[model samples]
Target: MVAVIAGPDEMVGRSLPFSELSDCPYVVLLGEPGSGKSTVFETAAKAASRSVTIARALRVSGGQHVESPLFVDALDEDRSEGSKKDKIFQLRDKMLSSSLECWRISCRVEDWRGAADLSALQAATTGAPIVVTQLQNLSVREQAKILTSRGALDPEGFIGQARRHGAASFLECPSSDKMGVLT
Candidate 1:
C-alpha cells in the first residue's frame, strides 16, 4: 500500500510506499474505517528483517526500551471506559517515558483530532521528526491488479460493471472476502 506523508517541515503531500518510512522516528498513519490500516501495519511488521515490537495502543505501557521498530495498531479500537482524548494523553505519557527510537501508530481519520493530539509523541521524539501519513484510496489500476491476482477471469469487466452500477467506491477499499471476488 501507499500513503501520502507530510513531514514536520513539509506540509506538501508526497505519495510513497509504506516501506519507505523506515527512517522516520515517529509516524502517525491515518485512514478511513476499513481502509486497511491494520493490514498495512501487519504487513510491515511481518516484513521487518529485525526484531520489531508490536502492541495495541490500549495495552501499551512504559519502562521497556524498544530501540527496534515499533508498530502500535488500532488506537481507535480502545474499549477502555474513558474518553479517547484521555487515552491519547495516557498513551503520550507512556511513550514519553519509554525509550522508543522508532514507532508507527495507526488510528482512524475521524478520531485523530489534529496535531494537538500528537504533542506528547512529538515531545517524546526529542528532535526526531514526526511524520503523518494518510493511506490513499486504491486506484482503478491497483484494484484491477488485485482482482487479477485473485483469479478473476475478467477484472476489467467487473470494474466496468461496478462503475456502471455506482458501486465503484467499494473497489477502493480492501475486503475480507476469502474468494477475493467483488461480489
Candidate 2:
C-alpha cells in the first residue's frame, strides 16, 4: 500500500508501526544519509520525556549504565566500521543484561545492513549491480526547524555554514507545532 509517493528530491519515509515505535524496548532508525533520522531521534527523545543521554557510536564503549533513556547515533558506522560490529554486539549484550528504560540507535541505510542487502540482490540478479541514492530532502518546515535547532545548538558554526550554503530560504518556512512527534 503506497500511501504517498514523492516526486523529484522526495521520498516516502517509513518506520515501524507507531505502536512499535512507541512501545519497543529498543528501535533502530535506518535511512539514507540526511533523511532526518536525527530529527526523528530528537523527537523520540522529547516524547519519551525521560533523561536523554546521547552518545556517538564511537563513544558508546565502556561501562555505560542503564540509568536513563539512551540514544546512540551511527552504531553501524565509525572510523573502524568493520571492527565496530563487535562493539555493537557487546553493547547489545550489555543492554540485555542491564535494567533500562529504553534505548535506540540510528545508522545510515548504506551502511553494513544496506551493503549486505545490496550485495545479495546483485548476486541474485547475476551481478547486474544495484545502487542506493539519496531518498529525500527536508521539507520546508523541517528545514526551518533544523536550521533553528542547528543555530541553537551551534550558533557560531551554524551562522557561517548557513550563509555559505545559502540556506536563507529555510527562514521563510512556517513553524509547526509538531506535537505529534510521538504519535
Candidate 3:
C-alpha cells in the first residue's frame, strides 16, 4: 500500500507489505541512506504498537542506551575497518544476553561495504530473529560478499542459532497491534 510521509514537506511513498516481514522472530532492516529506511522502521513500530529505542550502531561505550527490539539507525560513520566485524560480533554477544523480545536493526549498506554484519551479529548474539532491508546503494551480491569476507561461518544460520540461544527475537505482540481502539 502507498504510505504517506509525516514530515512537513515530505511526499507520499510506497511501502513494503506486512506479510513480507520475516517469519523469524528477529528482524534486521538493511537499506541505503535516504532510502526511507528509518521510516520503514518507524512505520513498522507504529503499526505493531511496539516501543522502540533507536540508537546509532556502535560499541556500548559510555552513554549508549541499549534496548530490546532496538532499531540501530545508521552506522555509516563507523569506519572501524578491521574492527568492524569484530565490533559487530561483540555487540551481538551483548544483545544475545539481553532480555529483549524483538529487535529491528537498520544499517546503511555502504557502511559495512555492503555487508550484513548486523544480521550475522543478531544471529550470533540473540538468536532472536531479525528483518533487514537493502540499503539503496549496494546490491544483494555485494552484501553477500561482505558477509562472507567477515568470516561468518553460517551466514544463513541465524534462525537456527536464535532457536538455540532461546531468545525470542521479536515481541509476541507487535506494537502495531496494541493501538487503543476507538469507541
**C-alpha local distance difference test of each model:** 0.70, 0.44, 0.45
Better of 2 and 3 by lDDT: 3
lDDT of 2 by residue, 1-183 (tens): 011121112223441222234543444455555445555566667776743344343245466556445665665455244553445445555554555445666666556455443333232222222222222343444444555664556544544565588854333222122322211
Per residue, candidate 3 scores C-alpha lDDT tens digits across 1-183 of 212222112222434453345343555555444555666677767776654443433346444445554555544444344444445555555565565465666556566533456445655434533344442332334333433555656534632453477632221112211231100
Top candidate when judged by lDDT against the true structure: 1
Segments in model 3 whose C-alpha atoms lie over 4 Å from true places: 1-23, 57-67, 78-86, 113-131, 135-183
* TM-score for each predicted model, relative to the true structure: 0.80, 0.46, 0.46
Clashing residue pairs found in predicted model 2: none
After aligning candidate 1 to the native by TM-score, how far in Å is the CA of 60 from where it should be?
Answer: 5.5
Q: Residue 50 of candidate 1: its Cα lDDT?
A: 41
Candidate 1, 63-169: lDDT as tens digits? 55554467777777662345544576666666666666777888888877676766756766768777888988777887888888878889899899988999887
